[model samples]
Target: MAPSKPIITVVTGTGAQGRAISRAFHRSGKWHVRVLTRNPTGQVAQALEMEGMELVQGNFEDKGALLRVFEGAFAVYSVTIPPWHQQYDLSMGEYEQGVLQADAAKASNVQIFLFSTLPYVGPHFMGLGGVELYDG
Candidate 1:
């Protein structure tokens, strides 16, 4: 019999980076990938599910959901898009989501917490104006 694989919970699993990360882990055959997304029926979510990933329906703002998803997870990969990139308003700021996910991972005793973040160039960089960076 094959050994049981460790579980890794992935946040924003339907997005580009999340999809890639989840696929890599799933293809490795070493980790059981659990994906968290608000829409379980979305195309990307369905694709991942078909590939043997377990999907947990939830949003970042719901602490209870986050906690449930993190439970028994050996590692977590969290990635949140900027507000400007999102089509709808998020219940909390992007930074807040990061902090919340970290806290959830800690509470769940997860061994690894991987947070993907981008640097805010804002007005500091040339030709980048009118960009408001989300502050936790």
Candidate 2:
């Protein structure tokens, strides 16, 4: 059976921005928001699920998981969160994750793709430039 409304995949749907975006989409009563999160049991994730969003367990590090979440979706909205444990910083890692997400969207044949991530800034500055490359 097919869904009545078009689907939009929201990456890191438990985060602040993802939550707002998901809520906006859900409130529209149009797009079926399919949200991916590492911790589905988290309070925010649970709340979003309660609001009629489809919550799926997944992480940015896994391309296969992202591909699965993006399947059959009309659009994909991705937001990359900087990893706290990494030594180098989020510039390289965030760009890598964005690349993976973009690739997944392409493979899924998503018509509209939106990427929200910090770019590669200088050493001290936040990674703000690399994200534009990834977004491209």
Candidate 3:
């Protein structure tokens, strides 16, 4: 049997950054791309699945689920959901989610891991030219 490619698990695989990262890994042909998302039946997730990526249905709030999501993976890439998406559920912010994922990655003994967060600029702030509305 031929040697298998390294696995790189991407969290939030249906989002913009996740999609880009997943695509880059697929294009390289050097690693098997695995994605974690809550909506595996969504169009984007289905598209990535069709492109040969393994999709793990999960959310960051559950570390146990994340550990499973990271299983058999050499690396994990994660970008916590941005502020805009948290409007409905304000229980956990991006930082909190990032920390949780980092802990899971460590526990899973992943070789490499990345955690990222991007602030959301509310629609009202878009009218203001060149101004960023960071809720810091």
Instruction: Name the top TM-score candidate.
Output: 3
**TM accuracy, model 1:** 0.82
Query: What lDDT does the true structure give each of the candidates?
Result: 0.84, 0.81, 0.82
Model 1 over residues 1-136: C-alpha lDDT tens digits? 3227899999988877788889999999999999999899999999999999999999877789999999899999988667666454677778888899899899999999999865345565357563574411
State the number of backbone clashes in model 1. 0
Candidate 3 versus the native: TM-score?
0.83
Task: Write the residue-wise lDDT of candidate 3 on 86-114 in tens digits.
Answer: 33343577788888888898898899997
Backbone clash count, each prediction separately: 0, 10, 0
Error of 1 at 79 (Å): 0.8
Evaluate model 3: give its lDDT.
0.82
Model 1, C-alpha of 95: deviation from truth (Å): 1.6
TM-scores for all candidates: the values are 0.82, 0.79, 0.83
Q: Write the per-residue lDDT of candidate 2 for residues 97-134, one digit (tens) a residue.
A: 88888888999999999988743343444444333433
Backbone clashes in model 2, listed as residue pairs: 119-127, 119-128, 119-129, 119-131, 120-127, 120-128, 120-129, 120-130, 121-127, 121-128
Give the poorly placed runs of model 2, Cα more than 4 Å off.
84-92, 118-136
Better of 1 and 3 by lDDT: 1
